[model samples]
Target: MSLLSTVRNPHDLKKLTAEDLPALAAEIRDFLIHAVARTGGHLGPNLGAVELTLAIHRVFDSPHDRILWDTGHQSYVHKILTGRADDFVNLRQRGGLSGYPSQAESPHDIIENSHASTALSYADGLARAYALRGESRSVVAVVGDGALTGGMCWEAMNNIAAADRPVIIIVNDNGRSYAPTIGGLADHLASLRLAPEYEQVLDVVKQVLGRTPLVGPPLYDALHGIKRGIKDVIQPQGMFEDLGLKYVGPVDGHDVHALETALRRARDFGGPVIVHCVTRKGFGYPAAEQDDADCFHAVGVIDPSTGKPTAAGGGTSWTSVFADEIVQIGHERPDVVTLTAAMLQPVGLKKFASTFPDRVFDVGIAEQHAVTSAAGLALGGIKPVVCVYATFLNRAFDQVLMDVALHRLPVTFVLDRAGVTGEDGPSHNGMWDMSFLQLVPGLSLAAPRDATTLRAQLREAVAITDGPSVVRFSKGKINADIPAIDRVGTVDVIYRSPEVTPTREVLLVAVGAMAATCLQVAERVASHGIGITVVDPRWVKPLDPVLVDLARAHSLVVTVEDNGRVGGVGSTLAQLLRDADVDVPLRDFGIPQTFLDQGKRDQVMADIGLSAQELARRIVELAASRAPALTTGEAEEETPAGQR
Candidate 1:
């Protein structure tokens, strides 16, 4: 059997000799490539962290000695060493292994936020808790160098230094978060890597002092002052040292023995200490190593040999549609500029950057700065388009509310992955954007139904010069367009059933990607002799006045969306109907207020009863109970065509 096959847990890993570790690292890398290629996960990060993770597991007794992973993308190797190797086949699928660290998976795992720059704060809290209990356990926080760019890392570090507790801070400096890490911290880390080896010089000085005569004790004390001066001249460890935390090497992260040695010293230091280890983001695989952008950070199912996707490409995604339209907008409007939070390529801002390099800014993993800075740009008479994932925007909620909306800046936010994004699990899903953004005053939110609507609505959003405007779309391929049969003000009528003698209209308000599903539900309901009128409200927020009038003409009204049920567009519109005194029985169909599991988007929707079949059944039941005679010819005639 392979050396890795024997490693059922950390205890089994400890059984291997030092000479066996290099082979084990090789075996683990090989296993990860094939496993992740099949499962489609954070492959590059895990590949880079094989030796570092092995060293960590070897040095720290996890569950007893807490080891936290920042962002959790680099935890696959940790999972393997902690007896989760058998669960790789079902990674990121429903009821399978999570792509990020999960506390339920094993005792070894902790801090499963998956958000960046949070492990250090969690480590500080854990360290304090351990100290209060008079426990002897250690706390090790493995944070990526990219996470250091976030303001939270510095906040935690300031407290950690003041506490002076036994906390081992391992800086996994691969120098990338989605893309190459930006700002002064990245530059400082690069300088640290280039600095002379200080540990070797310190060892030479110690030996020289030991070999001296009776003056050795006095000379050693005097040499300590000189050593500091020498360190200032050679290595730049002063930044961390000045913070009241001990600093260690720019050690080679791929060398398991060296990493283990560095970690051992940090573990024994009895105070906050940082061990700097330099690694390549995609260390093992040739295809990943050569990747310039993000180093293949996350990928779908691919061929192991070529590292190419196995499946053929689908229709143009919502991201690409936005990408193409934004470039055209940049060409047309000189005042239009773009901004992203370290995700230029992921959110389809690369073409915009390439065309207008001066106009585009990548503000590195700092969402708060991105939003507030966009507001500043707007104040200077520039229209800044802030493109970011809907989930990550939660980090800058305060900035969006107070800095942008309160100031009434003409900032446009392009939210990609705005609905039930399934594969990355509950934390990564963009399901909460509608509900959260609803609370922000002076903010108008739009959910486009297809590629055409996304392009048109995006233009409309940018045209608003008074307050902030948001245009959001879901993750996968853009749905086929549902052509409008008629237009009533801003609302697009996607489907209108044949006019019967007695019109019993059920207004189906479809939100964004749910338009197609609502159409299917309309067709199914129409078969039961109930006339269905499906309308796609391109702008979900700031309920269109035309919709209230349309609802009054209909017998029953139903709204379908991919966001959470509470406080969403449906709920807001229901309030509008109540205040307008329209006595239409309304039913809201959306994702329930619960943490959804990871799966394919379609499967997750079906599982949550968001499918057309389920929706049609529910609508039928509600109509029967509310007005049984409406489905028959006994209902009142619909309003005149000219009046509507």
Candidate 2:
């Protein structure tokens, strides 16, 4: 039987011989390459960590000896050995295994921090706690070299080194992040990756000297002392040693036996040691290795052989639309500089980066830093356009409030994935951008219903020199190819069927991505002899005065959005109507106050009652209630007229 099929847990893996370990690593890599290609998870990171993971399982007694994976996306191999191999088929699917580490999933997984630069802090806390309680078990933190760029990681490093505790930090340096890591730290890591051959020669010299006789032993010790002195002068990684942490390696991370030996030494030798393991991302997969941009960082269902995407369709996605528009705008305006939180390709800013290399900055997965940096860019008299995922922007709320909004900086924030981003699940959903950004003072937030409006609004956001403005666009294709009107404060009026006469009955105002669904509901309702007024309130925040005025004319008003019901655009509009004392009955349709599961976008939406059929039924029920109220009011008026 193959090593992968035979081994169910780490305990089983520990039983394998040193000769068999390479075959085991090979088996694990093949399984990961096949499984991830079919299910589509974090392929490159997992592929890179196979031998390292094997070495970890062999060296550390996990579930007892705490091995914390930083930014948990790379924990797939860890999961497989911890008795989750059978569950790999349904990886990242609804009700199956999560893409990141979850404490609920296993006892071995102590932290579920999918966000980068958080695992070290967790390791520090656990180590400190263990030290106080007099626990003997070791605490190992596996952090990527890319994650070192984050300020939080350094904060943890400082603390861990100062505490002088038994915390082993395995710096998995594969020289890539979601994209290739940016900043000074990434350059330092590149130097370390190149030093592994020299590191091996030093190890061989040390081993030979240790085996020598009495006089030879003293001479070897002197040579070792000199080597340490020479290392301090010449090594680039001396930064870690200066911080009170012992440094070992530039070790071969792909060689299972070498990694096992280094880890063993680090385990025995105490007080915060960083074993810098050098490995190749997309190591076994030739196609991924050939990929210069992130080595197929996060794949979506692809053929294992060619690494081409399996599913195919033709429609310009919101990301592509944004990329095309931004590139055109950058060409037109010299001051329009772009910024990203380590996402160039995902947010579709690759061409912009290529065109304006100096102007476009990929600020490593540090959202807060990106925002404040944009504020600084604005202060320097440049029009800074900051692009980031909506979920990630939540990390920089304080920066947006204090640095940008308080100063009234003209930073244009282009929020990508502004609605329910399916498949990635709760942590990745962009549903809360409107709800949270609405609370920010002096911030103007708008959403685009179609591609044309998305392009036009993005331009307007950059061109305007007022307070911070944001243009949020959803995932997937635009509803239609209609061009946006240049007017700033106007909302689009769609779904006005000329066949039916207009009535002051029900008005359906939809927000952003939900506009297309609302129009479908309007068409369905019209077929039932009820013509509903379907309007797209493109801009969510600064709740359009025209929407309120139109709602006052209608007897029943319903607001639809793909965000949380509480404090979202729908609730905001409802509050506005109530404050105006319009006396019109209102209903808000949106996502519920609970965490969503990962699944197909349309299927998930339907299950949550956001479909056209569901919304139409609810609207029909609300319309029917008006019959009793109308009858009672008319009868009372007639009686008063008779008495008069």
Candidate 3:
């Protein structure tokens, strides 16, 4: 049996000999590559964090010690140490191991928010609570150097230093969050890594100060006062020490012993201290290390031997559609600029950045900065297209509202992965964008049903110079073009059952990516002798005026979307129907108002009854219930198929 197999938990890990850990680290990496290759998860981050995680587990007793992870995707190694090694087979699947820290999973795990730059604030609050309760346990926050680019990290650091709490802030400097971390902070950290000898020089200076007779302790105190100045002379920046927090070495993060020693010394210091540990993003795996695009940060099922994706690539994705069109737009409009919050490739901005390097701006992990800066770019007569994941865009809501919407800036916000993004779990789902953005007055939101509409709508969003515009799309392949049989003003009539003749029993309103499912539902219902008219409202927000008339002509109006039912496009349309005094019974089918678990996207949709078969059954039931009301009224002549 391997050393890793013998160690089930941190207690077991503590029993391992010094020489046994190297073999254990190797076992852990081997296990991760195979397991994650089968399961498809955040493989690269976990692989890089093996030694650092082991060091943390060996030096500190968890649960009682309150070890927190920022952007918890890198917690796979931590999970393995906490007796979850057996759970790898079902990782990120339903009822299996989560991709991130789960409070319900174990006492060793806490703070399940998978978002970035939040660990420092959480540590500050936990430390304060422990201090008040007279608890002597230590609080450690393992934050990535990438997370430090966020403004909230700085906010927490300011308060942490002022409070003078015993919090250990481990800076996991792998220098990435989806891509090479951008901005001045990344440059500063590089400088720190280059000056590894400074740690030894500082130790000698401290020893010399201690030996001096009368001025020994006083000079040591005075040396502490001038440490920032001394750091500036030797290093490019002294920002950390300037904040009144003790700074430690850029230690070898791959060296478990060195990390443990640095952590132990920081833990012994009864004040806030930062331990900078440098490691590679994909340490052992040559394939992952050589991957320039995000270092394979998040990956799908792959061949372990070659590290290439095993699964066949699907058709042109919504991202690819945007990626191609945006490049064309860049060529047509030289004033157009693009911005990404550290995700240059994931959000489909890599080609755009490469074609127009001068026009692209990667603002690190700071989404809020990305938005406000886009607003500034718009004010400067440059059209800024901010490409970001839908879930991460939630972090910049305040900035989007005030900086862009309030000023009615002409910035275009492209939200990729805009709904029910499964496997990464609840925090990763892009289900809340439509509901939240509805409240923004001047923001016009578009959800395209196919690649054709995606290209058309993207151009429409960019042309609007008077106010902000948003284009949101899902994670997977773009659906085949659902040909518009006819047009009802701005709405595209996708499917109309020929069997029902003149009278339409149901008006199916499909929102964005839900068009294919709605069409399938329409076909299923048509078998039951119910006539359906399915339309895709290319622009969902500010309900197209023609929908009020379309809803009145049908017996039942069924709205379908991939977003949550509450405050979604369906809910908004229902309200509009009521305001227009249309008596048609409205039925909304969408994701329930609750947190969804990790699973295949199709499985989650089926589990939640968002499938075509399920929706067709519901629509038939709803139409049957309204039969009594329809019978009470006089029969009217059915209009011709396209006449309406």
Q: Choose the strongest candidate by lDDT.
A: 3
Residues 1-644, model 1: lDDT tens digits: 88988999998887889999999999998999999999799988888888899999898888799999987988999999999999999999988999989988888888785878899999999999999999998999999838888888889999999987999999999988888887888888888778756767878887887788776567777888878877787776688888988887888999999999999999888999999999998788998999887888998999988889999998799999999999999999999999998789999998998899999998887889999999999999999999999999999999999999999999999999988898899887787889999998988999999988999999999999999999999998999977889999989999987753234668889999999899899888888778789998888877788999999988888888888878887888888888898867777777777888899888888887788888888776655566544331233234111001
Tens digits of lDDT, candidate 2, 177-245? 878889888888777776645565677677876786665667867887767765654457778888988
Q: Cα deviation in Å at residue 159, candidate 1?
A: 0.6
Over the stretch 209-230, how does candidate 3's per-residue lDDT look in tens digits?
7787778677768877566555
Q: Mark the regions of model 3 whose C-alpha exceeds 4 Å error after superposition.
A: 206-215, 219-230, 501-504, 627-644
Cα displacement (Å) at residue 332, model 3: 0.2
Better of 1 and 2 by lDDT: 1
CA RMSD per model (angstroms): 4.8, 5.9, 4.6
Q: What's the TM-score of every candidate structure?
A: 0.95, 0.92, 0.95
**Top-down lDDT ranking:** 3, 1, 2
Q: What is the lDDT of residue 41 in candidate 3?
A: 93
Estimate the TM-score for candidate 2. 0.92
